[model samples]
Target chain A: MSEALSHRDRCAIAGIGATEFSKDSGRSELTLAAQACRAALQDAGLTVADVDGVVSCDYDLVSYGAIADALGIADLTYWGQTGPGGSGPCAMVGQAVAAILSGQATTVLVYRALNGRSGRRYGLGAPDPDARVGGRGAYEEFFAPYGLVTPGQFFALLAQRHMSTYGTRYEALAEIALACREAANRNPAAQMHERALTLEQCLAARPISLPLRLFDFCLETDGACAVVVTSAERAADCAQPPVLVRAVAQSTGPRVQPGVMYPMLMRPDITVTPSQTVARTLFSRAGLGPSEVDVAQIYDCFTITVLLQLEDYGFCAKGEGGAFTESGALRPGGALPINTAGGNLSEGYVHGMNHVLEGVRQIRGTSTSQVTGAEVSLVTSAPPPGTSALLLVRG
Target chain B: MSGMFNDVAVLPLMPVEDDHDTGGFFAAARRGELALRFCSECGQLLHLPRQVCFACGGARSEWRAVPGRGRVHAWTTVTHQVHPAFPTPYTVVLVDLEEIDARLVGSLPGEAELEVGQPVRVRFDRAPDGTTVPNWEVEA
Candidate 1:
C-alpha cells in the first residue's frame, strides 16, 4: 500500500535500555526517563552529546526539550511525539530512522516513561477538569454519560463480536492469557513472574467486563524503556549489533462502525482491525511475508487484542486465532513464539515501548527466553484504529 | 431539556457537553426525537456531529430527525466499576440506526440482554439531575 519510504533498512536501532517495569517507581517519570536515556546512550557507545533528536509517544509527560536539558545535550535539531496510545513505539523508531536518513538529526533516542500505577492509571477516568469538561471532552461527553468507558469495555465489545461471528470460545482467550503468564514466569522482570496462572485460574478470575476477566487486563505499571536509532553507517561502529529497521508504515481504517472510545464503526466488519492497512504495507515494504517473521512481539493490551492482532496481521486466518494458540504455540518452546518478555500481560506495560525492546532482544539473541535462530522480529502496536508496526532484522 | 414527562433518577458520572456542533442533537434527544447530522451537499447522514461532513467534505450540514429505531450492533456489560461514579454490572449497546449508515452508543436497562443484530428502539432515561439521555430497548 506504501510505494515510498524507499530508504528502508538504511537506519537501525543501535541501543536499547529500560528502567525495571514495576507498579511504583517511587520517583517522578522525569527521573525514569533520564535513567533509561543515559543507559541507552551508554549502550550505543555514544555519549549524550551525540544525540540531537528525541522521540517518544504522546502520553509520555516528559518533553524532548526537558529530556535534552536533563541530559545536558546542547545541540538540538529534531524532536517529535508520535500519536496517542500504545501504538507509537515502533513509529517513534521509524521517525528516528526517517530523521537520521534525511540528515535532520543523528543519534535519535526514543522512550516511553510513566507512573502508570502510582500516578495515573489509564483504566480510570480522567480526574482533570479540562479533559472532562473542555473542548476535547466531547469524547467523555458522548460516551461516559452511559458508563461506556475504559479500554477493557471497548475491547470486550470487539471480542464478543469476534466470538458471536466465528464461534471463538472463552477458552481460546484463556490460552492466550495462560501463555503470556507462563512466559512471564520464566522472565524475571515480568511483574507476575512468580505467579502460576492456569486456564482454570483465568476462567475463575472475576469478570471485569462480562466476556473479559481480571487476567485479561494488562497490569498498570510504572517505568520507562528507551532505544537509540541511528544511521546504519554510525551503527556499524557501535558496541552492540544493530537491529536494522527493515520496514515501517502507519495507517488507520475508514470509520465505518464508530465505537464509543474508537472511531471505527464504518469498517466492513468489527472483528477486523485497522492493523490490516499497516500489515499490508509493512510486508510489502519489507519484501517479506508472515512466514519470514521468525518471532513476534504483538501488542497485548488485553488477551483478546492479541487474538485480533494475530488475525489482522496475517499470523493466522481471521477467527482462527483461538486454535493458533491452543497448542502453546506462542510459548517459548512452541511453533511460533509471541511476547517472549512476558508481554503486557506478564511483563510490565511501559505503554508499548517494551514490545520494541523485546523485538530488538530477539534479533540480538540476548532474550532471557530467546528463540532459536531468530532473525526477523515483528513488532506491532495496539490495533483496530490508527495502528502501526515495524520489522527488525539482525544487523 | 424539553421532555419533562418522565425523569430517570440515576445521575450520570459526568456531564454531556452540547455545543454548536452537538447542541441540536442533544436538544432533539431531550425532546424525544433522534437527530443525525445530515449533509446537504451529498445527501448523506453524518454522526457524532462534526463541522465538516465525512462525505463530500461538505461544510453545510444540518440536523435531520430520524425514527428512533435500530438494531443492536454490538455491546458490553461492565462488571467492574473502574470508576466509583460508574455503577457496576451495566450494559452499553452500540445501535446501528435504521435511518442511516451511522451508529450510536447508548445504554439499555439493566435487565435487558444485548445480542448482536437484535432489533432495538431508542428511548430516554434521564440522569439523576433530570438531564434526558437517550437509551435503547429491544423492539417489541
Candidate 2:
C-alpha cells in the first residue's frame, strides 16, 4: 500500500457549525443553510465573502448559487454535488479536499440542511412517482408491486437474516439503542438529551417496521450543518486549529446493482462490507489502526449499520460487534469513544453532517462533551454505500 | 369535442415513458425471457441498461438471455402502500443472479414463503402495450 498523504498535502476542516436541533425550525431550508454557513464562517474567523467554493448533496432544497448569493459570496470557483443521500456530506468533503489540493479553490464550504422533521418525514414509506430520474424509479417500479417501499422494511429483512444466522437477539440490538441514548444524556444539544431510556422503553416504542422500533430509527430534525475546508497552508494561518484530512477513500459493494439482493443478502459477507474496504484503505494509507483512533463519528441511520461498520472498520472481528458494543464500549471514557455529539440515534439527523461537525469539535478541544487529548477521528456515511476516514492531529 | 373525448379515454391506457432507458427495457420485456446487457470487454453486467458501460466506459456491449434464476438476497414485507396504484401488503425481494454477478430488486408473489437463500425463477406480467415487467416466483 502507498503511504498516506501528509496533513500538509491535503485540506483541513477549519470550522464547524450547525443550527439548533429541533423538531421545527419554522424557517425555509434556504434560511437554515445561510444561518449554518454564517455561523461556520464566524467560527473560522472569516466571512462568507472568504468562501470561494461550495459542495453539497443533489437532494438539498437550496441551490449552491442561491446559498452563495444569500451568504454574499462573491464568486464560487468550484462547486460539486454528490448523488447518494447521507453519503453527500462525506463525498463533499472529498471533493473539497480535491479542489484545495488541485488549486481550484482555496476555501470550500460543505453544508446540508433539511426540513425532514417538520416538513417531509422520510420514515413514512411511499414511492414518489415523480422521482423517475434515477435507479430509484426502476427499483420502485419493480419492487413496489411486491410491497417493499419503506427503508425500515427493507433493512428489517436484513436484520431478520442476521438474527437467524448470527443468533443476534432483538435485545442485543436494543442494547445499541440504549447505549446511544446514554451517550446523548451527556450532550445538551442532543434531541433526546438527559432522557434516560431503558431497554424496556426501547422495546416498548412503537414499531415502524417489525424488528425496528421508533427508538431504533434515527430522528428527523429540521436542521442544517456546515464545515469550512481550506488548504493545510491556509489552515496554519487560520484562527482555529486545523482538523487535517489524513486519508479518504470510497467504495461500492459486490452487489454491482442498486437496491439489489446479492449485495443486500446472500453475499455471505454482510458483516464486512465495501465500506470496510474504504476504512482499511484509509487506515493503511494513514499508517493508523482502530487502536490509534481517539474518537469515531459513524453514520447511525440505524443501529445495525453501526455494528456492521465496527466490524468492517476492523474495530472488532466479524460477528463480534455485538459483544464489542456491549458494556458501554461506545460510551465516554470507554476504550473507544464514538459519536460523542450523540449519534443520529440521539442527535439530530442532518444526513451525518453533524457527525463531521462533532469530529472537528473533538480535534479543536471545544466539544461540549470533550474527550481529553483527542487526536484522530473517523467520520462515515451510510449512503452512496461508501466510507471516508480522516486523521486529525492537534496542530 | 370528439378528439378531446378520445384523448381522455386513451389517457388511462396510454404508455408513459419514464425515460429513454425504460423504452429499451420494455422492448426486452416483450419477449418471455429477461435480458441484461453486459459489456463484452470488461464482462460487467449493466442494470437499467444505459448507452454505455459505467464500470470501464466501454461502448461495445451484447444482450444475453439469462435463466432469471436467483436466490433471495434480501426482502421486506411491506404492510403500507403510500401510492394509490399499489395495494397494501406486498413482498419485495433483491434477487442475486447465478448467471452473472449481479442483483435486481423485484416484487415476489405475496403468498410464497421466502428465506434468505430461497431459489426463485423470473416471471413477467404483461402491462399496457407490449411491455412486461419482470417479477419473481419460487421455483417448483
Candidate 3:
C-alpha cells in the first residue's frame, strides 16, 4: 500500500445552495448554473471574486466558461469538468480539491445545473438515430436496436441478474424506495415532500421495466445545486461550520467501463459494481471504516443502485444487501440513515449534486431527517461506468 | 422470418443504424448468421464488436461464426414507452454465450415468461429495408 500521506481533512465544503426542486424551472441551464453558484458563494460568505476555480460535470449543459461569464468573474485560475453525468458529483469536488492542494487555485465553485424535466428528459430513451456525433449512435446501436434504450432498462438487466443470483426479492427494492420517499416526506424542498409512499403503493406501482417498478426509478426533475469548496483554513472562516472533506476517491472496475452507461452487461457478474473498488480507496484514505459513517447519501438514481452499493461499499456482506435494507438500517436514526434529504429518488436529480448538498447538511446537523449526531457523512456517485465517493466529517 | 416478428411489430423496427465497427455484426445478422470479431493476434472475441482488441491492443481482427445458442443471463419486460419507434410491452433479454465467452442483447418476439439461466437461441429479423438484427428465442 502506498504511504497514507493523504490529503484528508485538508479542505472542506464551506457552503451549499440549490434552486427549488421542480418539474419545470422555466430557466435556461446557464441561468440555473449561475444562480446556484451565486447562492453557494453567498452561503459561503464569499463573492464571485473569491472563486478562483470552477468545477462541474461535463454533462452539465452549462460550461465553466459560460458560468464564469454569467457570474462576471474577471478571471479563473483553474476550471475542470468530470464525466458521464450521475457518476460525477463527488468527483467534481475531488477535482476542486486537486486544484486546491496543488496550488492551482482556491475557493472553488462546484456546481451541477439542469432542467432535466423540461429541457430534455434523460429517461426519454434513445437519442436521434440519425445523428452519429460523439460515437453515441454507434454504441447505442447494439442495445437500442433491441429496445434496451433507457437507463432504467439497462439497469434492470443488472438488477434481474442480481435477483436471480442472490435471491434478492422485490421487497428489498421497495424498502429502498420507501426509505428515500419517507425521507423526502420530511424535506420540504423535496419534489415528493408533500407525497408519502407506502410499501403497497410502491409494490402496486406499474412496472417501468420488470424487477424495477415506477417507484423504483428516480424523479425527472429540473433544478440546480452547488457547493463551495476551500482549504480547511478558509472553510473555518466561512458562514457555516466546515464539513471537512476527509477523503475522495473515484474508480472504474477493471473492464467494466464500456459504452459509458450500457456496459453493465459486460461485467463478469452484473451484481458487482465499481463501488467495491472505490470503497477501499475512500475509507483507507479517510482513515475510517464503513462502520464509522454516521450517515450516508448513497446515489439513488435507481433503487437497485442503493441496494448493490450497500453491499459493494462494505456496509453489509455481498448478497446480504436485501436483508440489510429490510433491517431498517437505512431509516432515520437507524444504523445508517441514508438520503436524509430525499436523494435523487425523491429530492430531485440535479444528477447526484443534490446528494452532496445533503451530505454537508447531515454533517452540519441541519438535515430535516437528521441523524442526531452525524459527524461522518458518506456520499457516493453512480456505481457503473465508473464510480466516485466522498467522506466528510465535522470540522 | 418476416411473419415471425409479428408479436413485436412496431412502427420502426430499427431505432439505430450500424456504424463502421458494428457494420460486420449487422452484416452477419443480415446473412442469417452469428459472427463475432476475433483478435488475430491475441485470440480474444470482441462482442459489441469493437474495431480493435481492448485486451491485447491488437488491431487485426476477423469475423468468426459461433453457435448462436446461450442462456438468458438477465431480462426485462419494458412497459414504459421511451421512443415512439418502440411501443409498450416488449421483453429484452441479455444472453450469456458461454461457448464463445461473449454476451449479446436482443428482444424476445413475444412476452415470453423468462428466468435467469433459461436456455435461448438467436434468430435473425430482417426489416423491409433489408436491415437484419439478431433477436432471441427460448430454446425448447
Candidate 4:
C-alpha cells in the first residue's frame, strides 16, 4: 500500500502517435488503430513483438484482440481496458506502470480509436435505445426521454449551475474557445485550423443548449491516438527523450456512479467535477503543485468544461473560474498555456489520447505551439468528471 | 417557456423510458402522483431507481409519494432539435423536489424567465401516447 503511493516516476511514456485529425478519415477504426499503434511503437524504437501488454480506453470501439491481430503482436502478459471515458490514456499509463512494476509486463501500449464523425456522431444523440431498454438508469431511462439526449444537453445542466452559483458570464466561456481557436490557427494539423473564432462569433454562434453555445461543443472528429510506455530505465535509451510519468491518478466522486453521466443527485455541489478529487491525489503523488505545471492539455469537451477544470484542478479558487479564465492566460506565452494543440475544440477528439500526446510533446519541447522551457505538463480527461490527471516531466 | 404541453396537436416520440428501475415512476405518473424510490434498510431517498441500494448494498426497495414541489436546480433551453417530438427552443429542467428529498428532470412548456433556485410545481401532462409525464409549472 505504501509502495503504491510512492511509485510515481517509475514508468515513462517513450512515444506518442496519432492519425491525421479530420472530420472523416474514410477508414475503418481497426485500420486507424493499427496505424497509430505502429507509429507509436516505431517512434519508441520498439516493434510490436516487444509489446507484452496492451491497454485501451473504454470508449474505443475496436477491441484489444482485434488491434493485436492488426499489429501482428503474438503474446501478451497484461491486457485490459480502463474506461469508455471514465479513465483515459493517463489512467491506462497508470495501469501500464503497475504491470511493469509487478513484472507482469515489460512494454505496454495504450490506444484509443474512434470514427466519431463518419461512423457514430458523438455530438448528435443518445446511446443505443436498445441498450437503454435492456437496462438503463435515470439519465438514460427517466431523464433521456425528457429530451436530455446528447452530452451537450447533459453538460448544459453543469454549465447552468456553474453560471448561477458563480455569476459566470458567457464571455468567460468565449475566452476558452477564442484561445483554443487561435492556437489551432498556428497548428496546421488542427481540424479547425483556419477557422479562427472571435468573441462576437462565439457569442452569436447558435445555441445548442442554453449556457452552451455552438462554440462550446468540441469538434466531431475522426481519428485514433496511441502512446507507448516502458520502464523508466528502458525509456532512457529510446529514440525520443523519455517523458516520465511523474504522477497519474484517476478518481471518481464519493458515489460510484457508472456510465457517462453519474446521477448528480448524490453530490452536494453541482458545480464541482471529478477533476477536483483527481487533482489532489495527482499533485500529492507528483510532489508538485499546480503552479509548477508549465503547460496543460485539459480535456475541452466544452468551453465551460475548461472553466470548471481550471477551478477543479486548483488553478483558481472555487467560483472564481469565470474570473480566472478571463485573461489570455491559457493561450501561447500566457501564464499557464493550455491545450496548445487546439484541444478537442479546434484539434481533434481522439478521446483525450491526443491531450496526452500533447502533454508528452510539451514535456519534450517539440510541440508546434510549444511553451518555452516546459518541463512539466499536466493533462486531464473528460467528465462525469470521469477524470484522470497525469503529470509528465521531461527526462 | 410556458405550456407547450397544452398543445394537443403535438405528438411525443416516447414519453417515458420503461425499465425495471423506473417502471414505478411512470406508473405513479399515471395515477397523478409523483413517486420516488427509497431504500428502507438504508433510510435513503434514491432517484433513477436502483435494484439494489447503492449506499448500503441492500436490495429491498419501496416507493413513496412526494409533494412534487421543487426548485429549479439547473436548467437549459435546448434550441437544437434532438428529437422531433420535443421541438426546438424547449427548456429542460432538473428540479430539487421540496420536502420529498429527491430530484426530477422535467420540461417547462414555453419560453419563460427561468433561473436556478426558482420555485416550481409539477403537473401531469399527456405524451401523445397518453402516458403521463411530470412537467414543471412556473409563473412566467
Model 4 chain A weakest 10-residue run by lDDT: A129-138
In the order shown, what is each candidate's alpha-carbon RMSD? 2.5, 5.8, 2.5, 2.9
Badly placed stretches (over 4 Å) of model 3 are A1-5, A129-138, B1-18
Interface RMS for model 1: 3.4
lDDT of 1 by residue, A13-61 (tens): 9998899878889999999999999989888899988999999888789
Report the lDDT tens digits of candidate 4 across residue range A325-350.
Answer: 88768878887898999998889878
Give the DockQ (2 decimals) of all models: 0.53, 0.18, 0.49, 0.46
Q: Write the per-residue lDDT of candidate 1 for residues B27-137, one digit (tens) a residue.
A: 677677777778889977666676577779879988878877788887888888877656677887878888577777777655257677888877777655555667777
Give Cα-based local distance difference scores for all models. Answer: 0.81, 0.71, 0.86, 0.81
List TM-score per model, in order: 0.94, 0.84, 0.95, 0.93
Query: What are the fnat scores of the candidates, in the order listed?
Result: 0.55, 0.17, 0.57, 0.53
| Ranking of all candidate structures by their DockQ, best first | 1, 3, 4, 2
Checking candidate 1 for backbone clashes, the offending pairs are: A255-A266, A256-A265, A256-A266, A256-A267, A257-A264, A257-A265, A257-A266, A258-A265, B10-B128, B11-B128
Worst 10 residues of 3 chain A by lDDT: A129-138
DockQ for candidate 1: 0.53
Candidate 4's residue-wise lDDT over B1-80, tens digit each? 12233324432434444666767776787677788888989868766676578779898888778886888888888988
Candidate 1 is scored at a TM of: 0.94
Instruction: Pick the winner on TM-score between candidates 2 and 4.
Output: 4
Model 4, C-alpha of A265: deviation from truth (Å): 6.0
Tell me the interface RMSD of model 4, in angstroms: 3.5
